[model samples]
Structures are given as C-alpha cells and as structure tokens.
Target: MVNRSQNVYIIAEAGVNHNGSLDLAKKLIDVAAEAGADAVKFQTFKADNLVRKNASKAEYQTRTTDASESQYAMIKKLELDEEDHQILIQHCDHRGIQFLSTPFDFDSVDLLVHKFNVKQLKISSGEITNAPLLLKAARSSKPIILSTGMSTLGEVEQALAVLAFGYTEPDSMPSIEAFHFAYCSVEGQQALRQNVVLLHCTTEYPAPFEDVNLRAMDTLATAFGLPVGFSDHTSGIAVPIAAVARGAVVIEKHFTLDRNLPGPDHKASLEPDELKDMVRSIRQVEAALGSPLKTPAPSELKNISVARKSLVAARTIREGEIFTTENLTVKRPGDGISPMYYWEWLGKTAEKNYEADEKVRR
Candidate 1:
C-alpha cells in the first residue's frame, strides 16, 4: 500500500499511447521511472468486452482519432494480449516502479489480480457505476483507487455500497439501509475503509480549468473520510501541483512518449520532460508544506535576532538613571530585552550606564 500521509503517489497514466507495440509500452515505463513517478498505469481490457461494435467514440476521441472508425475498431487495435502484460510487468520490475493498469471488465480484473498480482486496483471514471466490476474488485481484497467523473454523489455512494456488500445487480440504486446493513459490524466498516480511495476527475480530454472543480476532492474526502486524489486531464502540470497543495494524496495524469503520436489520449498527455518537471514541483511543494504547528523554523531562528526589535537605550544614560520613554526605544539586533517588555521597563531605573544605540539589559 502507498503511504498517503507522506509524499503524494504520482501515477504517469500511459493509457494506450503505445499504439499496440510492446516496445513502445516498455519505453513508456522507462519514461515514468526516469521521471520519478511512483507508478506507470495502463488500461487493461479486451476491445470486444469493452465496447460494442457500433458504439460511437467520445467527442474528444473523434477529434484526436479517425472520425470514420468505430470506437470498437479504434480500441481493438490497441489491445495488449496476455504475453504483452507479462513483458510490461517484467519491464516495470526491472525499471524499479510499480506496475498498475485500470481493468475495464471483470475478466481484466481477474487478469490483473491472479496473473499480475497487482497490489492495488484503479477504476476509471466510466466504471463509477459498474456494480459487477466494483464487487469483483472488492472481493479481490486489494485496495482500490476509484475515479469519479460525470457522476453524482448518489452514484458514488451506490458504487461504494456495491464494493462493501458484494452486490451483484448492476442497475440497482444504493440506499442508506443498504449501507447500514453492509457496515452493521465493525469489521465490515474497517474493511471498507482499508479497501477504498476515491479520486475526483473531470471526464474530458484536456479538461478545461473551469471544469476541473478541484474543490470536489475535498468534498469527497469530507464525505467519505477516505483518502482522496485527483485524476487530472488538464493541459498543464499546474493543476495537479495545486491539487497536492489542496491535500490530494494521489495524482494521476496521462502521459505519452510523444504528444504527436496517433492515439485518443496522446494529445492531452504530458511528454517526458514535462513529467519530470511535474514530479519535481510536487516534491518541492510537499517539502514546503512542512508541519502544521506555527513555530520558529531552524533556518529562520538566526534571522529572528537580526530582524526583530529590542528595547534599547535611545541616548547615553548614567548609572541609577530612571529609564523612561525618552531614554529607551525599540531597535533591531534583539540580543537583549524584547520590545514586548517596553511598558514594564518604562518607569524603572537603569542598573548601569548605557551608551546610545545599545540594547537594554533586563
């Protein structure tokens, strides 16, 4: 399991950018490892199981891919067989990064768990209402990262219920009664909490910044009390970086070997150098977030005396002279009495003579 409390789990989503070539897929893994991403994710699904032969492409897919081709045809060409999965997993192990793939169907889910032995499962936005897939993933006993896009709070609740109760019906609505029954026991709730993480996403390619609605991540966190993250589809790295600052525990962004590649997701995906910059920036942000307690930092401790004010003698004073506002004022080099004690020292007598511009002693 990923340590959500520390660094954000960064996923370089290399979704179908390989264009059916195992060599290209390995290259994507290499890019993700070199870029310092925690994992490289791909999509796992048989084209026949994923889409109908006559199903249309999404608007963004139509713009990026061949308009005349059916969605099924477009997806069929990108399918990676069983041997391809093994090769990629070996490559990921050699490259020193976790291998992850979003399973689009029940068979794909089984393949990921039984064959690849994935530690966690990532569900795409389109599967938010996929009840059978949800139950299957939950039954696998691996943690899940679920993306919510083009979905309402109620739909998300239904999906969670499916995971919790092992629901078999795909179209049934989730209710409070169902939730209560599923979690009536302590172990059930604990199991649910341990097995789930939610992700907020905008289901568009190169999603508009206005549509990103990053605040929804916090909403999901508050609502579910589970770790929340962002599946960013925006054109730049700024949004994901900001998501980290806003308490995102994970960040999933699409990436490609080259943006000019002919594929549905290539245009919106980050190139290699940009991926590195995003990881670097996220680490910098994590370092800068630091502790919640407001105290003097080690680096700033030395500057306190140089920058803060202290009560000092405004003019020369002889021994036993009465300290007054005219003889004492605030100045820098706070090695003596702090100016906060000014009023307390105002009518007192000086223990000894003091030169002008000298810090006053207690």
Candidate 2:
C-alpha cells in the first residue's frame, strides 16, 4: 500500500449549502476549520455552461430545491463568481484551512487553475464522463481526487485515457520513469496503483446503508490493487468513521453549518461537531490498527505464571512407586515440567515422595 503521509484528507464539501449567500459561505469555512477538516470545498461553476436551460433536476436536486425551477435556474442561484472564489479562498487562508472547489465545466477549471491557485482539485461524479473537462484540469499539474458516482467502468476508462495521454510530463509514481511532471486524474482500473485511490460511494443523497455496498470498496482495493476511500452521502458521522476502520485512506463528507439549512445537500450534511468527531474517530482507528504481529506484547508476558499451567502431583505418592494418571495432573504456577510431558512420565518410577498438588519436576 502507498504510505500517504498526508493524514486522512478530510474534505468538508460545503457545496452550495450557503444558499447563494457569500456571508454564509464564509461561515461554512469557519465551521470546517473549527471541525479540524483539512480542506473546506465549494463548487465553482457558471450556471449557463453547467446545464442545458431545460435540463431537469436530479431526483435529489428536486427535493430541497424548487421542482418548478429548471436545473439551470436552480444552479444560477447557487453560482459562485470569481470574486466569490477569491473571497472564499482568502477566508480559508485566514481560518488556516485549505480551500477547494470542484469545477463542473471547462471554463470553471481554467478559473480555478489561473485564478484560485488550488493546491489540489476535485472532479465531481457528474464530470467523471466529461473527458474534455478532465483533460483541462489534468494539464494544470495539480493532484486530482476524482469521484466515481453513477459512472460505468468503461466511461471511467475513457476519461482516464484522456488524462494519461494528454500529459507530457513523467508521473511521480514509482512505476513512471523520471522525466518531466504534469497532472493527471490517475483514474484507471489497476488494482494496487499506488497513486490512485478508489472511493466507495452511493450516488443517492442520504444514501441507504444497504446500497452502500461498503464491501465493494474492499473489493476495489483487492481487485484494482489501489488504496480505497469513501465518499459518504449518509446522514451522519457513523458511516464515514466505519469506512476508515475498513481501510479508507481518504474520507470526503458533506458539511454545512446546519443540517436544517435550506439546500439540496444540507439535510444530508454533518454539522461542525459531527465533522470533528468523524475526523477524530478516523485518526483513532488508524492508531488502533497498529502492527499486525501477534506475539505477546510487552505488557502481557508478566502474567504467564499466573495464567498458564505446570505439571503437579494430584495425590500423595510414595518413593519408587510408579507415576499414574490418578497421581498426576496439570495445575497453575508454571515453573515445573510442562503437562505436555504427561505421557512420557506416565508409568515411570517416582524419584521421591511427593505431596498432593505440588509441582512436579522432571
């Protein structure tokens, strides 16, 4: 497994939960930093370019947002312009947390790259099929974490191909020869690909536990030979923390200042304390996994005498008499002949008189 020194990258995706208010957006950043998240993420996009004017809302999109509103109209209200991006980034800096925003289209990718100075990039599930968008982001040379929700295996392969072929620079992965450097999504089906991580996710908002198929995340790691993580849409901290125990290297969960906030995602998001608890639980689990060796620990050997057994005389025995099963047995205080020697000692002549319950010496 690739030992990623960057502790679990806990990204609190505050996507559109600000309800189109810049003040609320800054408040979300404060909550993320206070919750100890490594990054606070937003969505950067131009509504007109993001969706067709007539595109319908996703079943999830229709629930918290106005069903009568076209997807374009709904998204327009949530749009964050260049000024908003700059202010959010500066707010993140002031709060001492990294700011990240997923760009939904080609132009937004350019804006995030040339204008926002993002250290890492996130590709939303919807864009997993957007090869041109993936290519634009890949050329920027920033590391990318791509979400694969509602995508088929074949589509992911095509997008990954664009990233791999478009970049002229050599990859930092040990498998790649040393040369130049460029950015790529690192999204292939290769098991154990050190640079890539697969996130187990259910596309449903407030995803049902049964559909999570968390075991598939393990299957992905085993089948692809890469690190695996979880992108949780479940309503609480439990599922994400459980994913960490199951070997997730990264955990991306939605966070908003209040779950009651009016937005498509707020109802499924974690409040500040829950986000903190999730991160802390994940770190605690990482510590608990420890070394796999099974030998007695330094703290366990001292109890051996009190916990194990030794061979002892069960009844009084005369000198020169034969040792019999009735006269010998195993008991605690393990400094004498082990009980494993029972058959060998059976029927042997006794060297001396022995008292009842005394440890027997060979």
Best by TM-score: 1
lDDT of 1 by residue, 210-302 (tens): 999999988888887789989999998999999999998899999998999999999999999999999999999988999999999999999
**Candidate models: Cα lDDT each:** 0.89, 0.77
Clashes by residue pair, model 1 = none
- In candidate 2, list every pair of residues with a backbone clash: 190-224, 191-224, 191-225, 192-224, 192-225, 192-226
Q: TM-score for every candidate vs. truth?
A: 0.94, 0.82
Residue-level lDDT of model 2, residues 205-256, one tens digit each, is 9998877877777776665455678889987888888887787888899988
Worst 10 residues of 1 by lDDT: 166-175
Can you give the lDDT of residue 96 in candidate 2? 97
